[model samples]
Target: MTAQALPPVVDAETWQRRLDELRAREKQATRQLDAVAARRRRMPMVEMPGYTLEGEEGPVELADVFGDKSQLIVYHHMWFPGEKWQCPGCTGFTSQFTRLGFLDGYDARFVVVTQGPIDEALTYKRRVGNRMTWYSTANSPFGAAVGAPAGGGFAVNVFLRDGRKVYRTWHTDGRGTEQLGHTFGLIDVLPYGRQEQWQDSPEGWPQSPTYSRWAGSEDIAARYGPDGGTA
Candidate 1:
């Protein structure tokens, strides 16, 4: 990298002036996000089927997953059967959400629902030190109905409960779920930004292939295993 292309030294006033301009843009983006969320709040929801899922304790109904909470968020985690581990992207993404007790105050519950068997799913949960509660849709078509069929990619789904009935309000996959994981947002604020080739980073800033950092990352899971990401 050429020294000239690096982040240039600037007087404090010049830096603050540039920062003020960026802050204006940031605030505008925040307002736009609020608008999107407002629209989301008004979106129509579809009533869901009453399906039974396998929780760690045993079989559980869809509404029961909410545990008296009025709202539900499910991460349709991708799984590969007979393997010692599951999807690393799903693993790393879900791992970032631990001790999410604050959601209780909002009358909401968030949990993992996968097509993998309950036994193996829980095993992988402990293996990765993921702390989020997990459940299995191996027997029912729950995962398939909710956009994460067996052998498919990952997705995030939201639902609302009115008494015994459950309704799905929103669902998203691919990059749409990025907002839930703060790791990317935090990394993005850095000068280099995710450091991935796809990013529009400044010239001469560090860059790498997407997901290159996660390659051969079992040791990371092991490091978190004791304090635990845990069943």
Candidate 2:
């Protein structure tokens, strides 16, 4: 489908009034999000067992991932055993989180874990120029415990360390994982707003087959690679 013409021009006063109305809603949404976060902080945590995963240097325990920090966030990347490539959706989500040195400042660490072979994961990491730590749980039950079993979907898991013990504080999947990507946040502000068929845009606005059209495009893979090159 093609893009529709721009919205009709309106006077500055009308524009300002419309923006002010939306700004109120935005503020309300922000407060609602803050409330959710507050509740998340209070959620009870489960103790995590001594699980081992394969890293670049070899097998490593789950607690080791936290480094000297007390917090860890792991992206359960969906990479099934024997698959030639990792999940594109996971890659897209991770592409937004490569520069994670800032998390160190907060005494936190982030890592990507998959069920695929460690060598394969490393190859993809190098090809995509990922800077965050990565590990493979192919020989462990880490993926299943985190709701990302073999051939399963993506998830983000948060953990807290108390001395030598580790506890799972929170986990989220599906739309909840969207917080990791800025693209959707950026798209929501556009005039056409993602241009997805499901969006409630005005009549004649461009619309396409949601994520399928964008994910199936070769350009997306190319764009995710180094220097805008193909992966």
Candidate 3:
């Protein structure tokens, strides 16, 4: 698909008008989502049951991984045993994970779990140059049991703590949909916006697919993956 082009001459007044319109819409959407979230907050919870993950030091329980936090956000990072490509959306979400502690003000701990064999996962993280808490569930039931699709990588999940018991709260699996939340912090001030070509906005704006900044991912997804341009 071809990109929509902007007119050669957009006056200052027109530009300001467009910016104001977008900001107004953004505020309205945020309120609507906040209302919807209040409803979702009442959804039933599922006991997580004891699960373990292979951390840098060794096996670590799911509950212990939260450090001192009461809430946990886990990204089911996509990295198969032999596959060269990980999920583009997951990568994008992970790129946002660097700001984990910033979300700590809300009592949350964010971690990325990969399906690659334990050592392979550690090695890959170094190769990709990510310092985030990368772990492997190769020996546990966490990945498959928690809605991470068959081959892996489809969701970012949040779990809550109640005394000694932990429960799953919410999860999401889509591009650009992540901007709906105000909890997680941003790693850097993005000067070019998202730079992704498929954002749900007017023409000529830039939005980089969340994961396009990763090594070799640009060729993996030419324009936010094959379906990015669509709604």
Q: Largest lDDT belongs to which candidate?
A: 1
lDDT of 3 at 177: 42
| Clashing residue pairs in candidate 3 (N, C-alpha, C atoms within 3 angstroms) | 92-210, 194-207, 194-208, 195-206, 195-207, 195-208, 196-207, 196-208
Write the residue-wise lDDT of candidate 3 on 1-231 in tens digits.
Answer: 744554456899998998899899989988998998898888888899889889989999888878888998787777756754555555544554345557768888877787777777765555444557987888888888887754754567789987768899987765434653432224323333445555454466555675465435433233334433221
Write down the TM-score of every candidate: 0.93, 0.91, 0.71
Q: Tell me the tens digit of each residue's lDDT in model 1 across 129-178.
A: 77999999999999889889999999999999999999999999999999
Q: CA lDDT of 132 in candidate 2?
A: 67
Residue 185 displacement (Å), model 1: 1.4
In angstroms, give how far residue 3 of model 3 lies from its true place.
11
**Higher-lDDT candidate of 2 and 3:** 2
lDDT of 2 by residue, 92-199 (tens): 677677577888789999899988889988877766656668999999998898788988888999999999899999999998998767978998898888888998
State each model's CA lDDT, in order.
Answer: 0.87, 0.82, 0.67
Ranked by TM-score, the better of candidates 2 and 3 is 2
> TM-score for model 1?
0.93
Off by over 4 Å in 3: 1-4, 8-23, 83-89, 180-215, 218-231
Better model by lDDT, 1 or 2? 1
